[model samples]
Target: MYFNNNLKKFMKENEISLNQLANICELSINTLRELKNNPSHNTNLSSLVILAQALDCSIKDLIEDDIATINFEKVAEKNKNNRLFIRQQVFSPENVQYLRNLFLQVGVPCNISSYGRYKTASVKNEYELSSIKVDFNLRVLDLKECTILQIVDFYVSVNQLLLNEAVIKDTLIKAFETYARKLKLNQIHFIIDRDYERQDDQYSNEHSELQAYFTYTLGTESMLFVQNNYERSPFPELEEYQIEWRKTLS
Candidate 1:
């Protein structure tokens, strides 16, 4: 359950900012920031209670009813270890369990050997998710090069998180859903095509920029002070957002 799809809508209607909402709701800015930014991040029911109360709505209004939504993800950064540094830390049994929990929460199946270190000096923490889910009633048909007569599932993969150009979380799930409903279109493809490569100044129309589709990089704490472009996504939270639509260019 993610608030990125719905929280912004409520905030917009109320004409509030994170700081304002934080003061009004008695919820810390940090917690509210996470709720607003990280679609992959979940919060406790108690915080939901405070938020629903402050927003004058129920918990359901905040995180349930996922119909007519746009999904958000982080385009993973490549593991450029460079073999320059061997930073090693032993994964505690509890640490391994926590990781397993996170994977399960994301619906990712992972293989972590509790004792595999003995089998070999090295092991890979690999996970593959093909046939990643798209919103059943996707709100946008923003594909760059592709056209379809009717709604159809576009096959894609969550190839292990790798670096991509840019990222913007889809905080406008409601808006996109409305757009999809009007156009009778479903599914959003995160294509790294010409449209995206082109700078905003290169286009006369801003909508063509593909701001809704996103890619992400691993962010650092120093970036925390950067002003967020809400028009982007409510994500790149875990710093792993990459969705690709493939084709053969002639």
Candidate 2:
């Protein structure tokens, strides 16, 4: 669990400088910087109250729980399909460096991009066998069906140690919600693919046995509010199975 302070966003929106805010809150500049740099740090409640009063916003508006950094890139290639690809990466401060090292060790390329604390991977092969690719394809198809002609091929990938599936899902939901809200999108669509595979010892000991399902969501109120799961074989060529979700923001 992590908490994010929206001090930078609030400062930018209100055109308030760090010095000015410190003065307004009657706090030292070092203290303000500490709070801004580390929201998860254990600090006095009075500091938050003073900052909230100085910023003229509620405490909730300035702080949020389980906030992760998200980054996206628009990918398009004329030689292949005419679909646009939105490559997204999500991570938290604690895992940012770990993800970077993991990606490097896995030989995944980097595009030299950063958003908040997350960085983008340069190669699509990082998520080639993952359900993220399938979900991205589904989201692109959904947009085209909705008459969204300027659809970009969506390619999203994230680098993290294999944690519990539930934790990853929750992190993905929060990241997508932040991205959608950042773009001021009222409606979005996401397709989540969960891949399962097994080696068939009874059938010549081949590693061809596989099953997969997709969870679809057309979100208006919240990203994870409505979901429907369907069983299907979305990708057959991929060997290692991984699950992920992609969103179509409009």
Highest lDDT: give the candidate number: 2
Q: Residue by residue across 1-250, what tens digits does model 1's lDDT show?
A: 3333367667887788988898888788887888777644666778888998988888877773532122211111121231111111122233334444554444434443433221111112244221122221111122454321111121112222331222111222223233323333333323211122222221112233322332222221112112221122234443243323211111
lDDT of 2 by residue, 75-146 (tens): 122212332232222322333445334434434333222232222222233333343211122121214343
| Cα error, candidate 2, residue 202 (Å) | 31
Clashing residue pairs, candidate 2? 83-153, 84-152, 84-153, 85-152, 85-153, 85-154, 86-154
TM-score of each: 0.28, 0.29
Residue 250's C-alpha lDDT in candidate 1? 17
- Summing lDDT over every window of 10 consecutive residues in candidate 1, give the lowest-scoring window: 70-79
Score residue 240 of candidate 1 by CA lDDT: 46
Per-residue lDDT value at 158 in model 1: 24
Per-model lDDT: 0.37, 0.41
